[model samples]
Target: MKVNPTTLSWQAPTTNVDGSLIDYELEYEVGIAGDSTEGDYAPLATIPGQLRERETYVAPIADLPLDHGEHTIALRSFDKAQPDRMSEWSEPVTFMLATVPERPLELRVT
Candidate 1:
């Protein structure tokens, strides 16, 4: 997974078995694990479309509050042909939103 100023995107996993492509689903979570509540994450978003061979899937930037701490993000892929079947969740990625100092110090010269 990769994160920019406002977007977090990744490549959709390819189907291993023979099956028709249907759509893609993206899910994410923010905040420290175990200490965070369910509301801290965004609901899963579904994109309806067929996946081209060797094509990459990308999702739009999800709006989230910038808090100072380590945040976790996760994603998974689902097959439309088999709605019940889903790929294993990818490795969780961590990002930190640092807090900026309120005041800047001035330097004095003799």
Candidate 2:
């Protein structure tokens, strides 16, 4: 069986809580929950604020510790200016993990 990787992407926030334009680089933390349980969510990765500059972020799922089943994912954004400050987690998105069988190597007629 072969499990294909999943790609997670999200739009970067452009404003602060007060509705003012943001002026600092942003960092992000990705979280995953097994079976859609809110309390089961765990941190998957933390991206440094200074390493990204685009309005969108893309994360590869090959390295994630996901099982072959249903799972929910979400992310929060923060910055260096306020390390303790973090935005609310976005709406959770659930996805299914499946595996593909390999093709036959050889066949012979008997």
Candidate 3:
């Protein structure tokens, strides 16, 4: 996955089964972990497309709220042909958005 100033792009995985290619159902969720299994996790977005060939997919960063501190982003991919089948979720991508701090210092010479 590639993270830019305002976007996250990555190549979708292509899985072949039988003799046909499978479509990809991309889903993402973002939230912060509170306790170990509890947090305000909400579905951020879902992008569906056909994995006909090797290509790159991008998710705009503008959609996400850029708050200070660390944030967790999760992504999942599923087969379009088999709705019930899903691939193992990719590693959760964590990003930190921090504001530049200002410093006030002065030097004195005698």
Task: List model 1 lDDT by residue over 1-109, tens digit each.
Answer: 2334355556654444467553454222222334456324343445443332346544443445445566675665555666566555566667666655668678678
* Structural similarity to truth (TM-score) of each candidate: 0.45, 0.71, 0.53
- By how many angstroms RMSD does model 1 differ from the true structure? 6.9
What is the per-residue lDDT of model 2 for residues 40-104, given as tens digits with 9 covering 90 to 100?
A: 55788786654443855777776577778766778889886776878888887777788778889
How do these models rank on lDDT, best leading? 2, 3, 1
Lowest summed lDDT window (length 10), candidate 1: 26-35
Stretches > 4 Å off in candidate 3: 1-4, 16-20, 23-42, 48-54, 79-84, 101-110
User: Mind giving the per-residue lDDT tens digits that candidate 3 earns over 1-110?
Assistant: 33235666667655644555654554433333333553334455555553223476666676665666666666666555565665544566767666666686786788
TM accuracy, model 1:
0.45
Model 1 clashes, total count:
0
Model 2 worst lDDT window (10 residues): 1-10
Provide the RMSD of all predictions against the true structure, rounded to 1 decimal.
6.9, 4.2, 6.5
Q: Of the candidates numbered 1 and 2, which has the greater lDDT value? A: 2
Q: Of the pair 2 and 3, which is ahead by TM-score?
A: 2
Query: Distance (Å) between predicted and true CA of 18, model 2?
Result: 0.7
Clashing pairs in 3: none
